[model samples]
Target: MITPKASPAVFAVGSLTVDVKGTIGGTYLDLTSYTATASSVSFNPLGGYDFSFRENDGLSSKRTLSISLRNLLIPSPPDYSESVVTERGIFVYEYDMKSSSTIAVTQPNPNLYRYAFNDFKLSGKARHTDDTREITCNGFFLLQELTWPL
Candidate 1:
């Protein structure tokens, strides 16, 4: 007898925030929306049935992370300052609606997702739309160890 594969579960976002570094080190909790595109293998058709794909050493690919937040919460310049961009980096965290208030090692909460965009830098300026500011960040790879949160 063959066992059936486990079905995927969908959960609502409880909270979303971006951790900014540098002198303006703080967390932006007013996130309206976010999109994270993890690195994917690119293929080029060589000929009949042959194809060439980029090297996938797991960390040698391009990843993108974009977030939209309330314009009222952004600074005057709109885009992140140069210092912050050169500092550590920005991080995006998301928690499930049903996530526990407190998480412990023994009782790990699998609902928490973190996207640490490596060598992250501002790829796009803040585009004002209505009352929100959309910012896009580019990096090498989004760390996804243990669990596939993307």
Candidate 2:
């Protein structure tokens, strides 16, 4: 017999926050967009006609998070402070997604994906125009592990 297919789940952004030495702070409410990138490098050894072996260098792996927010009159605290940029903290991205209804029915909670950057830095450039002003923060995630809640 043919089996039925389940519907695709819909995921939405819940919130983003930074944790500094156990103190958590929220970003401006006008956050417009955010993106994350995880990457690594690989080496390939070529034989006579084709590649013989492929290897991945664990040390080359890196993760980075970038966020764009609407400019606020007040300056961001330690998260964006030059004196504290080198400090390590946890960057969290919470997501709300539709769960599978076939197994169980219940209220959905936001799922969190946390990244522990050994040396988290908050640096960005702000652009001002006649309409609006936005700032973008792009920094390194100096670690390789990402924690998830199941």
Candidate 3:
């Protein structure tokens, strides 16, 4: 008898929470989509013509998270407060996905990927009548943590 392989899992966007001054916000704007990008720098040392050496520059790595929210209605004062535009805060994003039997059997049935952006600061915000409002944030790095079905 042949063993069946585990099926692929479906992943979805869970939630995005903004922590401002120890208070959590971001309930007013209807978040539609978001994208996270991370980049690292590489260094190459001078070597012989036949040999080359390369190394990753961890210190120059950066993480950027951009979110687009539908402007269903006007946001309240606290939801998109002025502080969010002026001050720096922390952003937490959660992604959930079901796991295959083989993976689930060893770990949790469902997998949770939590990304925490420290020293996250608002890079820009754009709003237009014909376009969705977008918020861009940049951070030094992202701290990724994993949790089992919860």
* C-alpha lDDT (0 to 100) for residue 81 of candidate 2: 19
TM per candidate comes to 0.17, 0.19, 0.21
lDDT of 1 by residue, 3-103 (tens): 65553332222222223322112333333323333223221143111111112222323122223212212211112211112155533221111111121
lDDT of 3 by residue, 5-111 (tens): 55322232322333322112433454432332323212223310111111121222212222211211211111121211214543322222121111001212334
Error of 1 at 115 (Å): 8.1
| TM match of model 1 to true structure | 0.17
Residue 62 lDDT in candidate 3: 17
Q: Candidate 3 versus the native: TM-score?
A: 0.21
Clashes (N, CA, C under 3 Å) per candidate = 0, 0, 0
User: Residue by residue across 60-86, what tens digits does model 2's lDDT show?
Assistant: 221222221121111111112111121
As for TM-score, the candidate ahead, 1 or 2, is 2
Instruction: Give the best candidate by TM-score.
Output: 3
Candidate 1 weakest lDDT stretch, 10 residues: 47-56
| Overall local distance difference test of candidate 2 | 0.24
Off by over 4 Å in 3: 10-16, 19-114, 127-150
